[model samples]
Target: MKAVEYRLPKEFDKSFIVFTERGTYFPCPWHYHPEYEFVLVNRSTGRRMVGDHIGYFDEGDLVFMGPALPHVWVNDAAYVQGQAKEEASAVVVHFVEDFLGKNFLSLPELEPLKKVLDLSKRGLVITGKTKKEINRRINGMIGESGLRRLSSLFTIFDILTHSSEYQPLASPSYMQHTQGYYSDRFSKITDYILRNFQHEISLNEVASEANMATTTFCNFFKEHYRMTFVEYLNTIRIGHVCKLLADSDENVVNIAYECGFNNLANFNRQFKRLKGMSPSEYRKTLELQSA
Candidate 1:
């Protein structure tokens, strides 16, 4: 997506920011920034998009992203409609590579940290005990100041570099594509898909939106997304299905139709291809985890 670039609220006295974001909902649009970000979703449930990857996010969701990786956490319908019982909230930390000093990470002793930061180019979602410790330290940093706050950040990095409890969010193909500048045309196309994916979205329809012939648009999309339009559309539909499966008691057949799948078998096939589990199994897994 064509993400709007954002400037963090500057504080000349501080090298980094550690704060709690609390509100009825997270209001940031799909956006990017030059600073690396560490986010701990303390209270919320939503769809999170990082680069070309789409996944559901909930309370205790922790992700760290490299600079300029486009992302947004879109609250579920209940939060957007102000019907959610608990307000959205998160603990977020943002810092540039040189927040300590340009030469600091170049040090041999910091090689592991540098490696982790490179891996973060695709965004990393923390899990297991590592996530628990990082969340606690991030919350603690809210009250720290001066060198102490900075120290806490390094400590968090140390944990990340040494731990295996994380997974990359964006695909390598997507990351390779992001290295190039984004086109406004692709932005418009993705926006249209996101808005209208609940209905049948024809290749010709999106090609028209991009002001290109179907053949031309097909090549353009494949060049940027490394996938055919049908694949990308199915990806989006399946992502929404994941959120619905987790958040509602809706029947699988009905949910598939609502997400624009006309055939139950196709929905099941696509869901398993993308998510590695059947719809019922996916929901059951979440239930087991929560319990």
Candidate 2:
């Protein structure tokens, strides 16, 4: 289900927020970007669901997200309960895909960059030593507006284009959803799964909650979501595990059991099925990344 949030772009201008975030460091919920987004997490320790890409992100991480890809940054529950206020600082620049189109990079010049953006459709997260330098450049131009902001957008992209440490977080075939398309019923399903993903969920049980029969509910869900109930549920569960693996010191076996999978073997199989890497390996990658 889609536990999405909506914030319409009020202006039809050629640009938008060329910064990371605003107001307090609150949750953005699961959503998509209509514009190409470049974000650098200066200080963060939560798991992020970016497009189809799911993983744990910490300090010094840069993610390049393509237009309309669904993603969310779920703060560890403890943080939300006023546990840790230090978890803040992220830089995000949102611009139309063709903001400088037909001008800056010709199709031939864009070949390599296009590949980078294509890889980003599923979502790409970069954590490396270059983090400090990029942060430096971004900080140098924090309040930059007008023409300078546009220039900074290109500069941020330039840094990403030349960086070698980034990795694709989601699969290539992942498509994004618009805010208008996500409904309240979808939110209920999402909330239920997040709270109850640790147990077996039957179609009848969920359908009853949605106030529909088993078969009708199945079609209703798939028609709007494009993924079967189980597919969506597993994605949510997998996304959670990716977070637990990175930030928590919990053992893999315990994490699997906690996220609602029946057995360690099944968890490993499914984790690999959705993430293309085993839990331990994914954790190790984060360790090396955050080191």
Clashing pairs counted in every model = 0, 2
Considering only N, C-alpha and C atoms within 3 Å, which residue pairs clash in candidate 2?
20-92, 198-260
- lDDT of candidate 2 at residue 31, scale 0 to 100: 70
Q: What value does the lDDT take at residue 59 in candidate 2?
A: 70
Residues 129-242 of candidate 2 have per-residue lDDT tens digits of 656666766665667767886676567667767887777675322342222123578656655665677789888889988888999999998997678988877776776777
lDDT of 1 at 242: 65
TM-score of each: 0.63, 0.56
Cα lDDT tens digits, model 1, 1-291, are 246899878588998887788999998877889999999999989878776566889999999999988788888879878999999999999999898787978899888787678778879999999999999999999899998988898899889888989987864434433322335776688778878888988889999999999999999899988899999888778767766765688898999999899999999999888766798887775454333
RMSD of each: 11.2, 12.8
* lDDT of all predictions: 0.82, 0.67
Candidate 2 lDDT: 0.67
User: In terms of TM-score, which candidate is strongest?
Assistant: 1
Residue runs of model 1 more than 4 Å from their true location after superposition: 177-272, 275-291
